[model samples]
Target: MVKEIERKLPVVHVCTIVPISQTVGANRIVPAIAIPHPLGDPTKTEEEEKVIRRRLVEKALRALQTEITEQTVFTD
Candidate 1:
């Protein structure tokens, strides 16, 4: 579903805690939040979660400026 969109348009995915190896099966991968919550887990401490979310979001922003044509996974 996501890969299809990237193929047709310019798209970047946010993969926070997603392992690079696991993303292989998918058509494309982006650096986002953790697996359970791609935007940050609500169960964690607010300070901790906010810090992690900020870092991941930063990476996603960086990826958006690149000219990648393959499955690119950003790291934090």
Candidate 2:
């Protein structure tokens, strides 16, 4: 599946609910929020979680605009 994607698309970004280790088949990918949640943990207030999610999304957006050759770890 990963090979097919890499063969078909020049650029691809992925978001996962599971940890990175689970995607052992994919060749190249960008990190993303967890799968089902797509946001931070549930310990914070709604407002606080919103802010964190926004920040994480912004970082993902930035990753799309670059042409680097290595995996970038987008900090939340």
Best by TM-score: 1
Each candidate's TM vs. the true structure? 0.59, 0.54
Which candidate wins on lDDT? 1
Candidate 1 ranges with C-alpha deviation above 4 Å: 16-28, 31-33
List candidate 2 stretches off by more than 4 Å. Answer: 1-38
lDDT of 2 by residue, 13-63 (tens): 455632452355443344655666666757789899899778766765665
Deviation of model 1 at 53, angstroms = 0.9
- The per-model lDDT (C-alpha) reads 0.63, 0.57
